[model samples]
Target chain A: AQSVAQPEDQVNVAEGNPLTVKCTYSVSGNPYLFWYVQYPNRGLQFLLKYITGDNLVKGSYGFEAEFNKSQTSFHLKKPSALVSDSALYFCAVNYGGSYIPTFGRGTSLIVHP
Target chain B: DTAVSQTPKYLVTQMGNDKSIKCEQNLGHDTMYWYKQDSKKFLKIMFSYNNKELIINETVPNRFSPKSPDKAHLNLHINSLELGDSAVYFCASSQAQTRNEQFFGPGTRLTVL
Candidate 1:
């Protein structure tokens, strides 16, 4: 079975400051990791994904994630944060060869002005 | 146009009643999925369909059923709804059964009283 873990329940960052939301995964085979954001009463929006390529994967809204195989982590990062970036973020992973994807409890991101 | 869209963005019903949620995607994707987001914000996959064919079914209760009328539409019908079923149900679509990014709809807030 595949699983995802988000250690942080919430992450606080100031506007224009760097921000990160942590994520880790456990899968039997290789992993296809993804990051999504959800605003209140909204659906999950895709941010980025890691299939097989550079360890650093860039995504929408100037967001990116570093895929660390050894750490089993895919941490979402943004060089400069914006108040509009405040939302709930979730980390997801599906087995390399399966259609089942598991998501973690979302981490609330608070971007202060 | 919205890549994925769901109808009845909000639903409120009493327990033991039956309700349904409709979903559609215009991204020309072959796979559609239904995900549930609990009150605590833990999202999990409930079912998946590929080109109108059932492909992945999670350990969901029998009361919760999914129907894919075609490649572009997937509907969820919950019978004898319970309070535990009160959550946001999301519909999503992807290009393939695996190794593809999922586009999600705005989600339907189902409040089973």
Candidate 2:
């Protein structure tokens, strides 16, 4: 079974400061990792995904994540945080054997101006 | 145009009642999935259909059934719902079974009293 973990339930950052939301996972085979963001009372929006190529993948809204094979970590990062960036972020993984994506408990990000 | 859409943004009913949530995607994707997000914001996949055929069915109980009448539409019907069934249900669609990036519809919040 594939499982993803987000250690922090919430993360707080100030505007103009860099922010990082950590995620880790375990899978039986090659893993497909993804990041998604959800606003209040809304559906999740796609952020980025890592399938096979580079370790760093850039996505919408100037966000990026780095996939570390040795550490089994895929952390979401942004150079600067904005108040509008506050939302619930989720990490998901799909084990190579199955196409179903398993999601982790989301992390609530709060950006202060 | 809306990529994915779900009806009855809010649903409240008694524990023993039956309810249905309809979903449609205009993205012309082949695979659609239903996922439940609990109060704690943990998301779990319940079912997935591809090309109007059942593809992935998780350990969900028999009371919850998903019907895909066509590729563009997938609806979920719950029978004999319980308090534990109260959660936010999101419908998402992707290009294919192997695609990880999914476009999600506004979730339907089901509150079973």
| Candidate 1 vs. true structure, TM-score | 0.94
**Clashing residue pairs for model 2:** none
DockQ of each: 0.74, 0.71
- Give a tens-digit lDDT track for model 2, residues A1-113: 88899999999999999999999999988888999999999999999999989999999999999999999999999999999999999998986577688888999999999
Query: TM-score, each model?
Result: 0.94, 0.95
- Clashing pairs in model 1? none
Q: Give the CAPRI rating of model 1.
A: medium
DockQ of candidate 1, scored on C-alphas against the true complex (2 decimals): 0.74
lDDT tens digits, residues B39-96, model 2? 9888888887886457656579988888988899999999999999999999999876
- When summed lDDT is taken over every stretch of 10 residues in candidate 1 chain A, the lowest stretch is A94-103
lDDT of each: 0.90, 0.92
| Candidate 1: stretches off by over 4 Å | B52-58
Q: What is candidate 2's TM-score for chain B alone?
A: 0.93
